[model samples]
Target: MLLVTGITGHSGRYFLQELIKNKYEGPIRCTVRETSNTFLLDNSGLKIEKVFGDLNDQDFIDRVMDGVEVVIHIYNIHHSPNIVQTAIEKKVKRVILVHTTGIYSQFKYASKGYKLIEERISQFKNDTKCPTSITILRPSMIYGDLCDSNMSKFIKMVDKLRIMPVISRGNSLIQPVNARDLGKAFFTVLMSPEKTVGNAYDLTGEMPIKLIDVFKLISKELNKKTFFISVPLSLGVLMARVLKILTLGKINYIEKVQRMAENRNYSHDNATYDFNYEPMSFEKGIIIEVQEYLKKKEGSKSK
Candidate 1:
């Protein structure tokens, strides 16, 4: 039996689908918070058990880990560390912890909540008493049909405004990994215990592209004309403050955009060499995302 946390999230949902597609015979279980909407996984043809529980509650963690052998910890909230500790206590030896690249770079400008979560993850790794063999998987800007990530937001902004707001020079490079590829990599790590235990890998797509090029690709895919508006760093900060004042600022997204504009590149060399992880090209991922977006748009128009 395998327990998957964050089952409603982008990577988690795709991971579940991919496991089913590959004909995985193991029983799967997932945890959802009180308010989580998990109806989408109900008829997925896999033996799935959805348990309502809070990650912070030790008893809830124990209940969720009962009869579970391996656990994929993907929830990025305040109680993540507690949940991981509980998984270890339950004798769930193999655990995969999915983190984000934001932990490395975006923390500089992230809200206190984000900073605390990152700190907890680091502390959990440092604690030797936790007997679980953990593999930390960090990915950057994951995108797929179900994702409304930075890439998707960029596409929508381009569609609406016909212009992209470049925070600075827009020369910073980013490697956006497809959600499906990220799922595959997660499964591969979980399956190979000896090779992945206690190792951390940074995952990304096949190519590292500049921010401008990324927007250009989306524009091309959507057949939309794009104009680049270069906003100075100081002005970008000021605009962020203004948005926050207006109750319109998404701290995570704003911080990530600022970081990318300033250049934050994660090396995937370890991931590629260790697990033979090869992600699809950025262009291919964008094409698939565009097609899915178009389908959704058309469906909504018909309604």
Candidate 2:
């Protein structure tokens, strides 16, 4: 039996697609909040047991862990400790987690909590008392769908505004792995646990791209000539603060500006070698995402 969480989330939705694509014959179970939109899961054409409960609930976790051999947790990384503990207690054979590359961020506020969560997971893995083998896959900025607030928001902003404001002259490098690519990677790891277990893989995109180039690519896809105004990092942060104040905290992007100034490029050579993980190029992936976004926009208008 396989227990998969976050089946209704951004990456999870695509991961479910991979499972369907591969024609996985295992008994699958998923835990979701009562209000979580299960449209995709319902239409996935795969038999999945949907458990209604929070992962934070110990009783619920124990109930769902019954007869579960392997667990694929695609939910928030913050809940890893509890999940890992329960898996260990339940004597689950293997556990796969979707962590983030934010642990590598220079910003203390952003990386600190991830580091701590990872540390606890490490402790569990090192413990001789534990029987579960854990593999952690850390992915960079994930985009490719409307559920992605990062690139989807960027795409919408670029479409709505003629001039795009960038921080650090839009020179900072970012490697955004498509959600579909990430989902495929998860399936790849699931099939090849010998190569993935007890190790962590960085799942970045095909290449690192400048933020400026990203804006230009979207503009090209939209067939709109866009202009760029590079704002100093310090000034961008100040403006975000001002806007947050003016909006009565409805809009806050201070951390967003700070994060934009930092380079978020990572190597996936290990993932490629281990599980034949090949991600799509941003140029190609962004085109699909833009098309999907525009289609959805047109869809909403007709309703």
Candidate 3:
């Protein structure tokens, strides 16, 4: 039996898709909180057992771990460390932890609260002594259908306002990987335990490009003209704070922009060498995303 946490999330859903496509014979179990909606998985051909409980509760964790052999820990909430601890206690043989690349240096631009979370994750990684084989995957910005990350928002803004926001000189480089590719990387690592265990791998797109160039490419794809405006970091932070005061700042949106402005690079050589991980090109991912967006817009118009 294999357990998948956060089964409804971006990467989790991708993982499920890949698993089902490959026709893995093991039983799959997913854990979700009370507020999480599982309707997304309805009618899907994948055979899954859903466990509803608070991940922080050790008893609940044990219940989900019953008869589970390998576990994929993707539930990155406040109780993530506790979940890992419980997994160790349950004696699960293999565990794959999907961490964020932003948890590295990107936290410098994050809000105070997120920075603390990053610190805790780092501390937990350093302190863990579990006998189970663990592979920590740190992936860069992930974009795909239904994604609302910085890239998606920028695409929407370009379609709406016919302009793009460029922080500072817009020279900061970003390696945005497709969510499907990220899923494949996760699946590859999970299947090849020996090469991945006790290692941390960074998964990123094939090429890193500047923020300005990214927006321009999207604008070209959308057949729109983009007007670029530079905003200083201090001013951007002030604007974000003001937006928060007005309840207008989207939690993940502001944080993503701030992080992108920092121009951090995540290496993927370890992942590539270990599991033969190959992320799709940025252009390929963007093309797919734009097509989806267009289809969605047409559907909305028809309705």
| Number of clashes recorded per candidate | 0, 0, 0
What are the per-residue Cα lDDT tens digits for candidate 1 across 146-190? 375677887788778865778776788888888889888888887
Global lDDT of model 3: 0.77
Per-residue lDDT of 1-303 in model 3, one digit per residue for the tens? 899898788887788778878877777888987787787555466677888887767788878887778988876745556666666678778778787776666455544544565465556456657556667787787887646475788788888875556788688988988889987888888888878876878889888888888888889888887788888877887777777777754443566557657876677888888888888888888988888898889999999
User: So what's the TM-score on candidate 3?
Assistant: 0.86
| TM-score ranking from best candidate downward | 2, 1, 3
Number of clashes found in candidate 2: 0
Better candidate by TM-score, 1 or 2:
2
lDDT string for model 2 (1-303, tens) is 999999889888888989999988878899999999988778777878889999878899999999999999999999899999999999999999999999999888789999999999999999987899999999999998777978888888889999888898899999999999999999999989878988999999999999889988988888787889989999998999999999999998888789998999999999999889999999999999999988998999999
Which is the leading candidate under TM-score?
A: 2
Residue 155, candidate 3: C-alpha displacement in angstroms: 1.2
Better of 1 and 3 by lDDT: 1
Model 1 scores a C-alpha lDDT of 0.78
What are the lDDT figures for the candidates, one per model? 0.78, 0.92, 0.77
Q: List residue ranges in candidate 1 displaced over 4 A.
A: 33-40, 111-129, 242-257
Instruction: Judge candidate 1 at residue 182 and give its lDDT.
Output: 84
